[model samples]
Target: MLALLRPALWLGSCLRGYHMHAASTQQRGDTSLVLVDEARRFIQDCLLRVGVSPSKVRCISEFLVVADYRGNYGSGLNRLDYYLSDLQSGHAKVGAEPSIISETVSTAHVNGNSALGVFVGNFCMDLAVKKAEDSGIGFVVAQQSHDIGMASWFTFRAAGKGLAGIVMSNSAPTMMGPNSKSASIGSNCFAFCVKGEEYHFVLDMATSVKDIGAVEWAWANDEYIPHGWAANEGGLSTCFPSLALRTPLLFPAGGHKGYCLSAVIDILCGVLSGAQYATHITMDQNQPSNLGQVFIALDPEFFLPNFMERFDDFCGRIQNSQPADDSEPIRLPGELERMHMNYVEDLRAFAYPNSLLTKYKEVAERLCVKPIELAFDRCQSRKSF
Candidate 1:
């Protein structure tokens, strides 16, 4: 009996060791819970090492990390690899400062000089907000920059300063119209923020059916995309290798209506700003490309003395409207994003797939930053929901 018991105990110990090793591997495979503050410091340190001003580095790092923490993976830390690629290939000039090329009392045009778009965009928005504060309106057109991340961030910043804001940017040619067979347009996006007495009304959306990053993420995760979500050679929905060959051209969310908005934005941001538009633009594959961004800020008080009160009342009425479903209530624009932000904050981690985590680790390794580690807890006591 003693010998048999010893053998069973030994077997159990081996099994436990195997489980421990497996758990460690799983932890290493997960990279969603990257320490925000640590990542920010790492990026700032890198920028400083590359001779960027400390204050500017802080601003750019905050924008990037905030997007990461809020689960906007496309605009988040994942973008660092692209920035690094541009820097290494000399497509993007690291540490190059942006300059105002032309200016008026209420408007300015900036030359980013191939700098990182986030830094350039922030600088432009700051100038626009300052002008609006003094003149009741301001507009800035920024050209020759890379991906600037989420448009909502810049608009929200202006809104926080008691100004209504609108932002639009033209990206690389990655979208196609319902009638077009190939990518003939950029994934233009627009964001708006209106000030109110209670809470601001913020709206941000990509003109495409889905963000390109979403498609890439789905493909990496072995997920099937809905047919209507992508375009094909015949201008119909398809998932063929060729259709999926490039960043699959996304259908506009509201069909032709969103396409119209995309066209308008491309015209205003790309053509009007004298930047490359549509198929003429090139992807950021270590090549010189022209991208344009436009930001507008308005002091609502200039139009109406009771604008804030009226806006707040309108928001309340919308919030208290009848629900479309018994379970879930209707939510205004920006409400869902705000909720997700809160949820991510409480969780302290995002539900990222292992594949994405692998890519992130690769990026961290390439950047010489310590790869993120995952934390997990096992609950022995189960509770009924």
Candidate 2:
């Protein structure tokens, strides 16, 4: 398998950014949680080590923390090594700004020019939201970026601004179609967000039963991955993540229906954006991945009256439904994520598993940055959504 996360050969090439002088006493404590402020510092410092500017680092790091805050563990700090590897290989450029290729009142085509994926994602989302506010809807296609990570950050940004938001990203394919084994289409992911008067509706999902990242986490932690999420090297079903990563094929979410839907998403994000799709997207670590992303935002007020109230009503109805188990309460989508964020807010820290703490320490050492200060506390780690 052509794993993008493989360690880069040119590790010293992208290490010229960031400032001199260090934060002393940064790595002194052992802790159960990483605070919001501490996580930001750690992220910023890591990005700086990779030659990202201070200003750009600020924007990029926030969403990474937000992913952890909202319990999207895969897209959070756990994925930092993948991104730094992209930079170290000189594929993901530092300080390259997104360029608009063409634009109409409500639509746009952009070339990210190999910028940081988060920077490109934010640039597209901001433009989409502005256009939506002006013209009732906006659709933007962006190319030459990879791994935007946690699309909900962009989707929820638009939803917070009174717009219905949709974000989709295409990846180098690892999914297998019905007949072919090996690897085929991408494990494409999308995120949708809309606002209710009382709640935010967030549906962020990969077309696969579970993303490869979750499977990897299971492998590293020696936890059991549920059946049907992945397959072993021979392309047969397996709950073992270690064996699954040997070949790295994830099962489709809805069997045939999911395979087709994933293809359509590849069309929207890849083909429609004039980039590669499916097996065509590059996997070579030393070159730009040239993946494409799409963002669409719509002003709900333009098409419907009492939109928030109606959405809230639907959320209420869903939550009020009878549960299969008497003790477990039915919750709306994004509810548990909200609860997790609230938990962090209440504690003013992230009580992550010990593995993450170890990962953080490793990343800090590798990047030559101060590790995030963690103060030990004895508490059960909350299940990440």
Question: What lDDT does the true structure give each of the candidates?
Answer: 0.69, 0.77
User: What 10-residue stretch in candidate 2 is worst by lDDT?
Assistant: 1-10
lDDT of 2: 0.77
- What is the TM-score of each predicted model, taking all chains together? 0.83, 0.86
lDDT for each residue of candidate 2 in 57-107, tens digit (9 for 90 to 100): 888788788887776667777787788888889678876889999999999
lDDT of 1 by residue, 186-213 (tens): 7688999886768767787788876676
Candidate 2 ranges beyond 4 A from true positions: 1-32, 353-356, 377-385
For residue 95, model 2's alpha carbon misses the true position, in angstroms, by: 1.2
- Span of ten consecutive residues with least summed lDDT in model 1: 376-385
Candidate with the greatest lDDT versus the true structure = 2
